[model samples]
Target: MQAISYWLKAYGESHQNPINQKIHKVAVPGIFLSVVGLIWSIPQLSLFGFSLNWVWVAAIPALVFYFWLSISVFILMLAYTLACIGFIWSMEILNWPVLPISMLLFGVLWIFQFVGHKIEGKKPSFFEDVQFLLIGPVWVFFKQ
Candidate 1:
């Protein structure tokens, strides 16, 4: 099996419960969007008179890391990153409070995640390995 497959399988172990999977369907994307929105909410910088937020800069390292994992995963992450950027732009256009909204959603979704794990009677995979955190979103993406 490939590396990502292994990580996905291990992550899948505790997530076998149908209710847990359903919870993850919502929570994982919520968590991802929250983090992205928070990062994108950082103050913009003028570089050579070009305005850019830290989110664009920060995505480079993250994309690099994902690329090292697998090309397909890298492509998926790139698509997700672009979607997040679009979301941030839309929220800004609407004058929505990005940081507060992201944080509130993050907290609420995490609570649901814990509840789902409790229903499953198993610990989250991230407790065993931090990399599982990255694996989770991709796993959900492929499942869809």
Candidate 2:
């Protein structure tokens, strides 16, 4: 169980280049939102009067991961997760093509992310450990 600082520090190593940092400042959040959108596009289910979707189901483990790290991290990630969920919900209400849109945005953001890594001359830390995928939003959003 690495601490939040440990994960952030590790993730920061490959992000030292200013260009990479700037690209990540936007790409990370876009990637997060796009992922949530992709999950949100999944067919929803109902249980005991509550609607459940893949995004909602997935959020629990992710939130618990943050909670395991620190309370402040948990709170911040909870808020961020809810915000993304809300935005995805709005897209659903508006009849937006969330699936295709998320797929497109996800691809585009990854291109920027790979470019950032190329400029930094380091492979993305997620290559070392998949959990870095979860830490990325925390680093990009505020915890950095």
TM-score for each of the candidates: 0.89, 0.95
lDDT of 2 by residue, 22-80 (tens): 99999999999999999998888988998879897899999999999999999999999
| RMSD per model, one decimal | 2.0, 1.4
| Model 1 Cα lDDT, one tens digit per residue, 36-82 | 89888788899899999889888888788778779999999999989
Candidate 2's error at 54, in angstroms?
1.3
Which TM-score value belongs to model 2?
A: 0.95
Candidate 1 steric clashes: 0
| Runs in model 1 lying further than 4 Å from the true structure | 45-51
